[model samples]
Target: MASLAAGASFAIQLFARVGATGTTLLRVGFASLLLIAFWRPWRVRWTGRQLLGVALFGLTLGGMNLTFYLSLRTIPLGVAIAIELLGPLAVAVTFSRRVHDFAWIAMAVAGIALLLPLGGFARTLDPVGLGWALAAGALWAGYIVVGQKVARGHPGPALGLGLLVGALIALPFGVAVAGANLLTPAMLGAGLALAVLSSAVPYSLEMYALRRLPPQTFGVLLSLEPVMGALSGWLFLHQRLAPIQWLAIGCVVIASCGVAAGAAGRAPEPVVGPEPP
Candidate 1:
């Protein structure tokens, strides 16, 4: 929920003349600095494979954030999130053996089909924006895979270092596009708030939750993210969706819930830390 609210704030930043790359850099960079200060990742000795895992994790994280923001530039927040959700859905289903799981997958497919702007709806969406959302979704799958690999080590230090790698990847592009505009006092303040809201606070809370909650419980909670995102977009950015779109969102949400419920019997997959805003 915190991440959802913070995600909505990106729309505000977008309208504030900061490019998507600039905002992504600020969010990841500031969060990295805070995490490094608190966790001091440098103290952790690393094997080559662990280092490589962190780098791949960071790349996926960076790509997810960058493409998500890019999609937000042209698509409504709820719609973009709904589309991007297919990545994690795909990940969940891949490990499932139950025949019923295909029903959930079908529901999600139906939802996506509704949003695809085909036939009479063809004029409703921007193709480039949809493409970016799909790209973000693919990166999100990569995030899950790489995140699992990185989680075998220290969570705090690994995350901090991974975030640093993401920051480094995004910084040059941010600087080029936003230039001195990114350095303005107003933008700086907003960026800091965004970082704390989207990354720091959420990461801390999620870590705490992971220690206490069952994976199934956590997955169930995580499934609400897109709904929260839509609500936040409506409340904060005034971005409203049509009735059919809302139904599509509901289908996706149902699919997520079904997957989470079915996965309860098995050992839980490693939880991905704070999601990209």
Candidate 2:
């Protein structure tokens, strides 16, 4: 539900409401404050290796969101999300041997194919949007892998705070792009609220779920992001959906859900012992 609500918010293009860069800055800024207040990570001291790991996670998170917003400038929210989900889908396929997982991947591929308005190849494409979305998808996969590392290393709030430190580095660029519009109360409020909803809430929820679920199970469930985004886009933006579009979304949801159900009782992959101090 948090992921679905996030898609709805993104469909409104709140960043594009002010400007993508400014919107990114505002969202990160507000989220940083909230995370700092909630987690109080200032007290925690980090070793050099942990600091490097935190920085890596932060960099991936910032890059992912930046590219995603940039993609939204040209692409539909639903389609952009659908493509972004491919990053994880790729990762899942690489790690799994199960034949059913391939079937799920095929469902996702079929859904994405429908996004192309394929009557004539030359006349019907958003090249720039596809470029941005694909770029974002690569970064999204990096973010997930880095996020898992961060989650394992520190408590959530502290890791979240450390990630914010790197996100702040992105502010100058975002401010430059969005500038004065970013300062407007309306934009600030919307961007800040969006940060809480899209980043803060979903991050917390997913972390909670991860703690209780196996990595493969979590990966399977995460595949639902695209389908949820399509539904949220339809409901919140009144984005008109044709029957075929609805069928595409249904296929994604069912395939992902099937993967999740199959993984429910399976043993988690073995956790090797930690390295010696």
Candidate 3:
């Protein structure tokens, strides 16, 4: 989570030079290169179904991230991500068997109400930016579902190759938005670090945690992501929060904690994604 927070903060700062789309493109592009090099995933054969699924996985992953950074141009980074997490949180409880999980749903609903207005979203908010965030969130949820499917069917090396495909799709946009400026060494170095923080560190750390933690506990811990994002923004970016926004963050956190606790002790269920770009 700390890694993810750093990745996002770095993204905001990096975008000042690269532009948001360019930055996302570079990060994912570099990440794919690393995975392909390490896993050498092209050696294996793939079926039509696997290819299609992986293609969709990459598209969703790239699309979600592009939209997210775009949304951050107008919204606060923490707020954008907190809203985005509704995607995964909804996925977690919506597919579960437990009736007790609705508590989490209720908590989520309350949080949304606070962030969105009782009066009017259109009148009070940036509808366009929020709409972009929603698109990213939905894509994020789809990526989780599709990604797990890919991981289950192909497993280890497939994950690496699938990420490469995702990277490929985003490259043109990166070049278009950021242009030849992206090739400069300074941006490349920082972009590489962002990719590592966003991808490698969290990937390894979460895998380790999964061995020791139950799904419910994992869910609860995952809920801390927004808090972590906000903290990193505050500490590094000096992005302050309003009392209302903090309350909304709190409600969502509680709701997610409830969901995690409800699903505790269960064996690992894959809610796979592109290491959370």
Candidate 4:
């Protein structure tokens, strides 16, 4: 929910003379710096395996932000988020044995089909944007997988290190695109806000939630993200969706909700880590 609000603000920031890459760099960079200061990752002794997991987690985190932001350049925020959600949806359903699980997956597929430019009604969406959203989805899946491995203990330090690695990965491209424009007061302020809203606060909340709730219940709550994104985009950015698009989003959301509910009785897993921004 917070990410949705932050993403709406980020869309506005993108129009403030900063490119998408630059915006991503600012977000990850500020998040890294702030977290590093607070968490003091240097104090933690890292094992070789832990270091590798953090690195992989960072790679997926960077890729997810980069591609999702790039997609926003050409697609509406709600639509992009709905498309990108396939990653987590896939993760949720991957190990399921229940017959109803496949039904949820089918419904999600149907929703995606409606979003595609396969018919005249859906032809307005940009193909390149769709591709970028799909790429983000793939990277999101990677983020969840690697995050589970790296989030075992000391989530704050692990996240701080991961953000640093992500910032390093994204910074060069941001510099190349936005150049000195990113250093302006307006951009810096907006970027800082983005980092706090999209990264710090949400990450902390998710980590806390994971510790207290079953993963399935948490997943069910997280399923509301697309709906929140849609509402936020509508209210903040005036990015209204068509009726069909709304229906499509509903299908995906329902599928996610169903999957989460089905798994709600399962035993809770140990805390892994916070999800990527």
In Å, residue 275's CA in model 3 sits off its true spot by 18
Please state the error at residue 133 of candidate 1 in Å: 1.5
On residues 160-273, what C-alpha lDDT tens digit does candidate 3 reach at each position?
A: 665577677778888888898899999999889988888655643544454444433444346667778878889888888778868977987887677666656666655443
Off by over 4 Å in 2: 1-13, 121-123, 269-277
Q: Considering only N, C-alpha and C atoms within 3 Å, which residue pairs clash in candidate 2?
A: none
Report, for every candidate in turn, its global Cα lDDT versus the true structure. 0.72, 0.67, 0.71, 0.75
Q: Roughly what TM-score does model 2 have, to 2 decimal places?
A: 0.87
TM-score of each candidate?
0.84, 0.87, 0.83, 0.86
Cα misplacement distance, residue 128 of candidate 1 (Å): 2.5
Give a tens-digit lDDT track for model 4, residues 218-272. 4334556666776776767677777887887788688777767776677667655
Query: Candidate 1: minimum summed lDDT over ten consecutive residues — where?
Result: 212-221
Model 3: clashing residue pairs?
216-260
CA lDDT, candidate 1, residue 260: 66
Highest lDDT: give the candidate number: 4
Lowest lDDT 10-residue stretch of candidate 4: 212-221
Tens digits of lDDT, candidate 2, 100-123: 777876776676666545567525
